[model samples]
Target: MNSLLKCRYCGWVGGKSDFEWDHMDPKIKTESFLLDFLQGKLELICSGCNRQKSDKTSQDYTFWRWLFPRQANFGPIRAHTFMDTLLQRIHREIR
Candidate 1:
């Protein structure tokens, strides 16, 4: 088990287990509503992010919506193009 894991969103360092596995990947390129199952994860995130997502809070919800724009199908969806777009955005930021 990893004693120290850094969050990709906020970069908070802690035990890997402390982070909750986040469903849905932000980096999917295709429309989630079109697919039946997700191609990404259940990544370990901090409680703060988890709570925000669970509650669908304004800030967190918007953040997630921007990161992963889905049609609210209530299930997994194939995510490839979404990831590509997300990666492009990230790359643009670094450049």
Candidate 2:
């Protein structure tokens, strides 16, 4: 059997050695993680992104923007509604 790690948000599969073992906030997880994120309670952040994001926001990477873009013309749903869609996508693809 092959061992691989995949990013829950983007589905980027990586080797075990290259992956970080982490989980969503214990109180949130996938089913409730989205709610936490939108309510300013949860952060589905990646380790690599720690250097960039803090309490407010960051522009260096694409994850935050992709998930919660200020401009709403492109994403399939608005930031508020997309939180659910994003979580659904993560569950369907990675969980």
The per-residue C-alpha lDDT of model 1 at residue 39 equals: 49
| Count of backbone clashes, every candidate in sequence | 13, 1
| Candidate 2 ranges with C-alpha deviation above 4 Å | 26-95
1-95, model 1: which lDDT tens digit per residue?
44787655555677754466555444443455435144443456665556556644335555765687552112222246568899999999999
Lowest summed lDDT window (length 10), candidate 1:
70-79
Clashing pairs for predicted structure model 2, backbone only = 36-42
Task: Please give the CA lDDT of all the candidate structures.
Answer: 0.54, 0.44
Instruction: State TM-scores per candidate.
Output: 0.39, 0.29
Query: Model 1, 41: alpha-carbon shift in Å?
Result: 2.8
Return the TM-score for candidate 1, rounded to 2 decimals: 0.39
Q: Where in model 1 is the C-alpha error above 4 Å?
A: 25-38, 55-95
Question: Every model's Cα RMSD, please?
Answer: 16.7, 17.3
Superposed by TM-score, candidate 2 places the C-alpha of residue 7 at a distance from the truth, in angstroms, of 0.7
